[model samples]
Target chain A: MNTESYLDSIRRGLRGAMESDERVYLIGEDLLDPYGGAFKVSKGLSTEFPKRVLTTPISESAITGLATGMAIRGLRPVVEIMFGDFLTLCTDQLVNSATKFPLMYRDKVRVPLVLRTPMGGGRGYGPTHSQSIEKMFLGVPGLTVVSPSLAHDPGTLLKRTILESERPVLWVEYKSLYPKQLLNGGDELRIWQVEGEDGYPLAVVENFSGSDPDVVVIAYGGASVPLFESMRRLIPEEIRVRGLLPSRLDTRTKTPWWFSEITGREPIIVAEHGTRGFTWGSEIAAELNLTFFGRLVAPVRRLADADNVVPAGRGLEREVLLNEEQLIKAIVESIT
Target chain B: MILIRYVEQSLLRLYAQGLMGGTVHTCIGQEGCAVGVVSAIDRQRDMLFSNHRGHGHYLAYCGDIHGLIAEIMGLPIGVCGGMGGSQHIQRENFYTNGIQGAGVPIAVGMGLAERFKGTGAVSLAFLGDGTFGEGAVYEAMNLAALWSAPTLFVVEHNGYAQSTPSSLQHAGDLSRRAEPFGIPVTRTEGADVIAVFEVANRLLGQIRAGKGPRLLFLDTHRFAPHSKGDDFRDREELERINRECDPIQRLAAQIGADTYEQVRKAAEIEVDIVLQELGVQ
Candidate 1:
């Protein structure tokens, strides 16, 4: 049986959303027929929905502002930013314009725009192309940031963001996860999905035997692949590990629903593909520290890339980025 | 033009009395651009986006004198429920924001949406001469022309961009800025309401007829300070502009003295009544 890749899932989701809603439009640079897109996630889409899928010039600011206007005027526009790094060009439109419209206009209008772009660093594309910069948009009031991983169906999350969300969403897609296969529950490891308050899905993976986990690792997006690998490898070593992979990273200050499932005494590791410092892991660690204060055996540890810029060399890039070995080591150290 | 003049003049008085807070960018001398261009568009179907100096545009499009007063006064009964103050106002198809050159791309998108939805409605965006410095405006124009979006760009050249003169802000002729984008450009003396209305009507007609985007440049002057008491121009220059480019005075000359007095008094009384009802006076 042919298994669907993460990229295939996202493309199918885009196609399904456009086919179902006449108001949904796929707009970006180089999204035309024959070229598809830079990452090919939009491959063959323009050919299928010739008029709805539009290729725009390399003007990120105008493209984002145009999409905001379209969303304001009752059309659902999904803008593809070529690469996640280019999102800096769209900051003004997203931060000042899109987020301000609803409240600034006193709830008279809604800007339902979805800006999807690929982020992450394992490919040695140099510093500019591979950084996970979604952290910059985490605290924006009206913007919803979500990064789907291999443990979940990115296509479904993207479709929901396009069709259901009334606020502007920054959908971060990891370049590394695009080629990976979707996780299907097996006997050795079982996977289950939980929905967030805003209807975003979170994938939970644990051993099929259902014994209480020795430790819990919370991660999302590109970090999930290594996390799953580490969990599987630790099974033979007799270490029980439960993983919480959330597609939606912006939970605000609220703790995850599965936070109560884990014993406060067990060490919790918040892993991400983004570089260290004020980041998604840092925020989660803060929340965990606040909620489970005095009850935990050890403080919440964060696993992420080094603070240095991602280098172009494969070996240098791997050294800076998180890998299965690093996660395994962290997990082993935390439990022992 | 008379209503906008009286409304802004009353706002200036209230602002001086310290009853209204924040800065009010009035279109006192440049009322012709607001009245002429706004009157030409289909208010029910067409979309309008205005910039920082947008009080006159808001009044012309909706004539909500009480709503405008209440909005600027920070009342819940205002058009934006006191949330937008003066720089931002929303009434039906009319929208305003304080940012310069940012509304152009939004207007293009709105124009494209109308065209795609088969509405046959044109989106009109208003900007000042100083807004030419913003790169987003050029980007929006390029996309609008390339995609054949039904958008009309209105440039209100009011001499100064909040104290900085246009000569210092722009290098070349502002009227021909849109030429490279292949958008047809037109220029008009903003003090003549009839001329502005005629040109705007023609350009908007072309846009609505699927002729893509057109640019209407208005050579205008603002009688009031950029916001409040920020004018640094020479006294003689200000007086000369006031005498030559006052839309209200020009319109009064067109009509007889008696008719002008009657219309002017009526507009004055209308503004007075609204201010009285709002209890701001």
Candidate 2:
């Protein structure tokens, strides 16, 4: 069977969007010719659409603000911040300017801008370069945060975000998942996707076909990699686990349809690659707790990396980050 | 300039009476830059971004006195439906924000967008001497020069950033700040609206003709306290500015007393009508 890498899928999605829409422009640093961006997600895009692909100076704040301006003036600008950690430099433009423009302009204008950046650690990129800091942008009012996992087609999600989303979006690509193959169901696993009302997709993975799930673990982005492994491992122990990986991460008001499909009696574990406390997992767990109040068999559990800077060494990084073992332990504990 | 003076004076009255909420930064002494630069731009196609002290800019751009008053009054009939209040106002091709140096890059982007669309429009952004402290402005200038974006960076050197004097906050001359970026810089005393208009017209003509980015530095001053009573300048110096650097006074001296009085009265009546319609005392 043929499989596509997550990185290639994202590139295909960007190329498709630029092909269809003339207004779609890519603005970033190191996005021209051979470099094709730091992660090579924008590989060959500059050559295909020369004028539309603009290689900018190392000015995140200005580029973000410039993208906002372009978006305001009826152009779709997709900014690639080489690393997700550099998003801090563009916070003023994203938070105070881009997110506030539509409402501040009394809905007379829309900032249809997309900011794509690679996040997360595993190859020992160390503290500054390898941090999953999507949690910092969680509750920003008008900004939509989406992280596509291996379970879902990364390119499709990116293309949809560029063509459809009228609001500003922060599309987080997991750096570690770049080389992973897109997940397709085999004989032992069932993989399917459910589309959200806003057009974001949620991929559901289950090991058993007919049996009811003992626990429903919800995660997104790179967290889904270990989640699928834990689900397959638990099959031997007769512990049926179903995993839900949504492309959209900011779920403050909108809950996924699968959240209602699962029985309240089954335990739900919220897993994330970032550190615990005041995070995506916390928000999801809080929402689930409120919705499944009194009906849930146990408290909503959160599985996440340790609340510390990711260490540089491979051994130490593995110990600090979330893995299949940690997820399996959390699921078993929640069910028991 | 007369209309701006009347509107700003009326806003101050309303602010003192506690009718206007939030804070107001009036360009009482810097109307020359607003009127001159705005008069030179094509408002229908070109875009202008203003800073916190933007009342004069807004009035000079579209002369929507009633909308400006209603906006400051926080009424639904305002330009931005009163959601923007005094600092944040968006009408057609004009926009303003309270943040100091945030608008520069955004304006540059608008200029680049216009260039890409072949719209023949130039983007003008206003900054203060204090805004030189912001790193984003330099980044924007670098990008604007590198990309050859048709953006005009207008610096209104009023000499103070809120309460801090420019001398204490900045080193070297403010006019030469854009020198390293290779963007051509023009300096003019902002008290003469005609002179400002001439200089701004020449620079904007170059920008519209696809000459990359140009910087126009206006040597101006603000007679009113920054954001209602934050003035820490020497009292005698302010009095000297009021007498010598007032744009309205200089224009009046040139236009003859009779013509100036007629224009002043016409502006006063217009402002009164707008204030009465908005139900502000």
Candidate 3:
């Protein structure tokens, strides 16, 4: 059997969802026609499922709004924004609208909208293209952020997110990893959990929460790899961090309660691969305070890309961001 | 006696005594437009979303004035558990918000939801002429037309937009703006409640029948200043215009003296009972 590529895995995810329900469709810029997509994860989909894959305008606002519209209208619209940086152009739709659209509608509307955006900055695209903004949306009230490593199956992650019915999800698949090999040197993980072979799994496995007796480390997108690596290196010795790869930087998850157990209202540690100011770490710390501020063990400290625009050169870019060393230091420093 | 004027009077009276708290913007002299379009709506099936100045829209839907009154007073007995106050009230058929143009896109979302669910529900968004300038409203209009969502855009053009009149603010005719978006447009006199309701009813039915997501403009007057707190008053001619075009009086006249008296007595009794209940609570 052919080993799974991230692109093929994502395609398998889309195909599974397409087979499972008629409501699932590919909607984004250049997602249709001879142009499958910027990353080509939606490749060959346009030819096979003409109506299922739709081409939208350059309006990220419109794309997300359309996704929100379609999602509530009972269609599972997987929207693609070419880069994670473009999300700033439509913060209202993503933040105030999509994030809260479910709650403002009193949970009467279930937004099964998935946004697929490629993150990381290696090709010298400069300020606009070089951002990793997953952390900026971490604390939004009703969204899920999933960034699975190469060890995790993209197809499974995508299916899980689409199958979920409660809130919208922002699935940030790494651009570099689009061609990476599968989890554990294996093919796609076959799930018999879905009731029917014909139907998609329950909203593409929105796997963000976990319960175990160890350290809770939150990571998104490509950062999951480094986070996992840091945990591996730190394990069998110093820090016993259990990596928690939340699908989105959202506030609704019960994982923060898990965080509360370790820190005891004392400052907790949040790590991000993007701008430090609007970090998801601060969001978790704030929530910790919001629920139980006075009794915290310590103040929350966050490790992020030091609030500067991501530079072009690899050396300069790496210098600015928190790598595994910095991540471990930040975590150890927080509750120490 | 004019429906809009009567509705405005009730809204203003509540505001005057500080009974209704969070920001109140009544379409006092501008009632005709809301009454005109909303009167044509089927309260049972059709849905309406309104701007901060939305009492007229809800009243036309036969909303409980006491619930509205208790709501404006910021009471828990109010519609949205005292959370929304004046701006955010979600009644059975109508939902109003205080956040300027925020309701426009939400209305579109709700409209799309209604359409997809095949609920046979036509969504109406009551925006001020001022909000027409908002991008969210235009985005909503574009999406509504693009998806053919069953929504009606009602711009209650009541002359002034909080000190700046519509003439200075809007460069083109409000109805014509929708033409570029492939949305059909209509204009009705706002002071004439029947005219507003008649046109609104037709458009609403067309929308329910999957023929429309049209925009309707009702140009009228605001006899009172923007709010009860506004020191500014309409000049003598403006004042005279409001008294002369009062809708309840006009509708009462058209329906005959006997019918008017019966409706008036019933409305008065209803109001009295509401006030009594409010007092008890």
Give the best candidate by lDDT.
2
What TM-score number comes out for model 2?
0.98
DockQ of 1: 0.73
Ranking by lDDT: 2, 1, 3
Worst 10-residue stretch by lDDT in candidate 2 chain B?
Answer: B224-233
Those runs of model 2 whose alpha carbons end farther than 4 Å from true positions after fitting are A252-258
Compose the digit string of candidate 3's lDDT tens values, residues A190-292: 2112222322221111112232313445555566555655665665455445444444345454444344234453344566677677566667656766665
Instruction: List the candidates ranked by DockQ, beginning with the highest.
Output: 2, 1, 3
Error of 3 at B121 (Å): 4.5
Clashes in model 1: which pairs?
none
lDDT against the true structure, per candidate, is 0.89, 0.90, 0.67
Cα deviation of A199, candidate 1, in Å? 0.6
Question: Candidate 3: which docking quality band?
Answer: incorrect
Question: In DockQ terms, which candidate is top?
Answer: 2
Clashing pairs in 2: none
User: For residues B126-155, what per-residue lDDT tens digits would candidate 1 score against the true structure?
Assistant: 999999999999999999999999999999
Q: Please provide, for model 2 over A121-227, each residue's C-alpha lDDT reduced to its tens digit, 9 standing for 90 to 100.
A: 89898888888999999899999999989889889889988998787999999998999888877447788998767788888888887978889988999898888
lDDT of 1 by residue, A1-336 (tens): 237889999998999899889999999999987989999988898888898998999999999999998999999999999989999999998998888898779556989999999998888899999998899999898888999888788887788789988889999999998888888774477787887666777788885364678888999999987988888888899888888888887775477665655677678998998888999899888888888889888989889998888899999999999999999999999988
Highest TM-score: give the candidate number: 2
